[model samples]
Target: MDARRDAAEDGRETIGISWSSPTRPARRDRRQRPCAVDPVMEIEIVHLDRRHAGLRIADPARLAHLVGSLARHGQQSPVLLVKVEDRTVLVDGYLRVTALTDLGRDLVDAVVLDHVDEVGALLLRHRLQARRSTALEDGWLLIELLEVHHRTQADLATVLQKSTSWVSRRLALARALPALVQEAVRVGSMPPHAAMKFLVPLARANAADCEAVVVALGHQRVTTREIERLYLAWRRGDPEQRARIISNPRLFLKVEAELEVPPVAPDETSALVDDLEGVAGLCRRARKRLRTGVLERASASERAPVAAAWRETREALRTLAARMDAEEFDGRPRDTHRDPAAGQRRPQPSPDREDVEGVTEHRQEDPRGANTRGPTLRSGIEAPAPSDADP
Candidate 1:
């Protein structure tokens, strides 16, 4: 038997053994025979290499925490790596490697896989183990596996330990959102579901408009409902309306109103009209008083308390306006209109006599309608009838 010691200057050591027999062939012992071992299953120290596909984007705060944990307890989990022709690529455990590197470690423990499929499966396993993967991360991984690797969704689903539907949804979300929107989601500017729900449909319907809206509101953290409404308004509105909605969405959403006018007896028509005019005058007076007494005087320090009071009043009015827009008032569908320039209230178009009579008849039939307020004028006075030859 001959034994040799091979030592590298870097302190790495290797041992080799050989036996020579004369006259008789050496019989190998069954127990000592070399058994095939998967290199992917073995954990060994390796040089950290980052030039590889990974789903996780390193977070500074999380990396800091990992650095601290590693400094105290050392690396509890081995990172996964894939061996290519001449280089090793990272598959998972980016944070661990990053922490270890920051700690001035020369080597990292890794499980190196030979095949790309095994690499993908282990990537997903590590992702699940970390439990920090976002939908966008899943989306990116799904795309890599399906498009780049040419893998089926079923195969990925099995590898990811998720339902086929889950894989499909992630892929669909990735495909539906534009690259800009995806970046916005990735950087925490836009939420994943918001991008998937609002921007995806907008992109499908009109890519230019979707891009425009994203460019406009990408910096703001908009809610899902706000995004939905903004998309709807953009889809249905003209250029000016779209701009208005994007700039002041809450104002646009709150400006909608439905108005219905009921018919009165021909003899009582004049009186009903006069009462509406009176109500309109009262509202105009109240608005004028509020504008002059509170808003105009708001700059004065003496009026600070009054300004605070006005804020409460304004909120209450907004609540009332929203409620009024939603429900009918005075036994009629409430007539509401908003002047785009000033955001002021305007009356809805008056119902025709026939429609008014229909509502009147319904009100008589339903006793509950009697308890509600009578048809209220939304806007004060009617516009003058157009002259027959005006055109």
Candidate 2:
């Protein structure tokens, strides 16, 4: 016989026990069995313990209302359970059982069923009830129901009395999301399928950044086009676009500025050129000032002024000639005292700051710090020697 027909036949039998208390019945009374030899699959009321189902029925509001009704009038409907290893297991109406338990009922009505495996029961329960649940919740139920059963989408649709397309679409949406976004969908702030699309951009963002984006999309009533625009920009990885999104107020400001500003006259080209020339002139003056400052600093140094910084061009030429002579020296030790003008080695001076005027000869200072010839003025001004100008 077909399983449904058999279950229906078994369901017609009267278990013949009052659900007033736990010790009311031990086993189903044989007399209340279906009189017909071929029983049809249908559910009937019986006495049974309504715990240990392990499946969560997510309709809390319905359950609470049902509990309140049961509290006043007592259970009128029978929960369905299947026999497993000499123990009865709940197959359907877990919420009803929960409502009855919450109402403090000692015993409740149920139907004894042939053992349908965990998968079949889960699929039946979800199909019968959880279809009314939110997409995210339904997705979780489907996953939980399938984990032990390992049913394909077509099998799920067949057993659950739903279309294969519906099952596939919902499963795809649920599985596409990361855990955190799934939580958001469960909490009902985001639409489950729409939230999947949002994840594409949000995965690139950090937690806080994602929160900001979610808030913006949630609060701004942002259109699909606006969201797509932002998402595409994010994917392009443009720094300027990212900054614009980060500071959205600036985008408004830019638009406002454009609206308020006046257009420039096409014939006023001379003014733009004049402005460019003014900027160029200012840059030129700044360069000149910087060069002059450097020259003054070099000239004031205690050592001889750098040749390049000298005011007279002749001094620069002489400095270049002296550098060339040093670089082109052949087979001779480099003489620091060589004069470029005279082309010969010059006399060395004492370590002390002194000047000697037109003196081609020199006397070395004694260790006692005295020289037989005293210091004399050099060829130039006698105001102070270049080295003596230090202090």
Candidate 3:
């Protein structure tokens, strides 16, 4: 349908949208003008008042796509306008106005909401594009309304259909952000979410370092994951490492990526043997530690997760033992001396074996009331017979 068409014959109403709370204020409280049906109108680009233009952080890629789309398909949506004094203020569609200007067009299709103010329009998000605002964007708006525009938190909470706690958190986030980081976010040089998650805490910790990092990332196309990795490393790094990261974060990310790419193994057998040996080494170390009663000194809460992990590992070892003894794995002839069912290995007979012909006498007893096995007790892992995977 044409934007300029008469809506009386069709019985069309207003924008036809509502928000979180369906029960709105009395019509006197709202700027809801009577819809004499409705007609979308065209406004000149020069007449737009962009006072709230910087409220949204413009994304470069999104703006470029919008420019291309406007060129190929003309304007499919209208920019929203609110009247202020003698000037017509743009309440929404900053990107559209920008895109049209980039295309060298002077006129833009727009809708004028009668008697609506900037605050009302922002609260309603009065536009066709249902784009959700990020938390950082919310912080910007909340700060402006409270400190500069003189709006109270309670009043905003009522209008936004949110609690006062939510408003306070947004204000805190905005307060902690450094000025330079804010500029980076506004111009699309830095991702808003990355700033919110990683940079905010960083600024609180060391504002100078955060500023340096933001400057380092100004023109780079680094992702949120990469930023997170950088932030984590910076937290764990020493002063010198942190300085190097601040100087060239992109290079650090590249180096980290290279380190994760493993060297090609000679063969699958070699890789398998390496993994088995690693597991065996860990188990032997664990047994040595357990003999020292490491678990005996810890509280139950601290030991719960460790106990659960140990139970899972023990069950896996049992399954491995059963599979090792199966004929399909060991092949036809079974080895005669591989019994670990009694938690002991059978060593081959040698001439160096000690003679035990005449040493027996009265045995000693420990405090736990169990008889000692011998004068000396061995304390080490029993090396199991190698599995068939050794080949």
Candidate 4:
């Protein structure tokens, strides 16, 4: 979707406009009042104001997914809105509104909040959608509030019910992340979550390094795993190593590719035993961490992101267990949504369980249910965060 077009024609497509007051009252900075939500109603797409749409990071993947959902199930959720001098201004659900536009939708399910100005609506949106928000999104949103709305950090902290330090950290996310990286995220050239997790701190450690890395990456579709690898290596590596990473990440990846050393194969029966022991050890360790983790020490709002992350982790483990059960019953293969080796040649089975030269060890899926044999398979799990980073 062309983001620029969103701001262009509010009246371009006329579909099911319930209210058609041509009088657009002038916008003003007014005092915020209590939220007054109207029942969900259909509003004309052309009448909706999306002047603040540019403030959001434009993610094509997210928009595509939303478009598909809206197409399949219709707009089950409502877009948030506020009355600005009688003009209905969008406060949240830009993606949903965009999806409706893509689907040639005339009207949108809207929750118009009364008695609140633009500033109050934005704060309400932040509180309402904090769970689904990424650090990049939150940073930019906070920046919008601080600079565009002329809000002080202390005032924002008080309204958001957070400490001033927490507000600064969130502001620092935008202040600290390189503008180059921020643009990359905004245009979908880079991922917002990966930037939040790996690149922000990398940028703060050395802004030039962040700039160099962003320039080196260009517009390539990099993964969370690759970015994570680069960040960890850069964190620990020396000056020469870090420079090489910034200037020539591909070469770093090439060197990172395990040299043609064949991992010694363990006895099959013993390997099974070792794998079971490893799984048990991991479970025990995870349980111990959960028992002693910072959840008990954190406040309610502070613990929200962490608790949400845990729910995701729990759901993922549940899915894995279900997949395992399915495999036990049917031994069928699962579809790959994103595969690096989509067009790669089938790896030949190693005779006598011996390693083959030039054949890299990757734990990839085969839709054909073929047993792929290799000397070793490297784990590709994302590195677990020691603690959840506040979004």
Best-fitting candidate, measured by lDDT?
Answer: 3
Residues 165-237, candidate 3, lDDT per residue (tens digit)?
A: 9899988987798988888788777888888999998999999999999888776556788879989999999
Candidate 1 collision pairs: 259-334, 259-335, 263-356, 330-373, 347-379
Query: All candidates' TM-scores?
Result: 0.43, 0.35, 0.59, 0.52
Q: How many residue pairs clash in model 4? A: 1
The order of the candidates by TM-score, greatest first, is: 3, 4, 1, 2
Tens-digit lDDT string for candidate 1 (1-391) = 1111111111111111012134454233444222221322324235445644345543455567667766865654345566655666666666666677689886765555444444454444544342455676788877876776788888877866789999888787778777877777755566667777778888887776677667777476767877777777788889788778766555555664222246554767688668656756855675566545444434556455654654564455445435445555579754443212334454334442212211111112246433222222333322111122222
For model 4, what is the alpha-carbon lDDT of residue 43?
93
lDDT score, candidate 2, position 94: 62
| lDDT of all predictions | 0.54, 0.48, 0.67, 0.66
Is candidate 1 or 3 superior in TM-score? 3
Task: Please give the lDDT score for candidate 1.
Answer: 0.54
Candidate 2 residue pairs in clash (backbone atoms < 3 Å) = 7-41, 8-40, 8-41, 8-42, 9-39, 9-40, 9-41, 356-378, 357-377
Q: Could you tell me the TM-score of candidate 2?
A: 0.35
lDDT of 2: 0.48
In model 2, the worst 10-residue window by lDDT is 379-388
Off by over 4 Å in 3: 1-39, 126-129, 261-391
Across 197-245, the per-residue lDDT of candidate 2 in tens digits comes to 6653465454444455555545323344444545555556576766556
> What ranking of all candidate models by lDDT puts the best one first?
3, 4, 1, 2
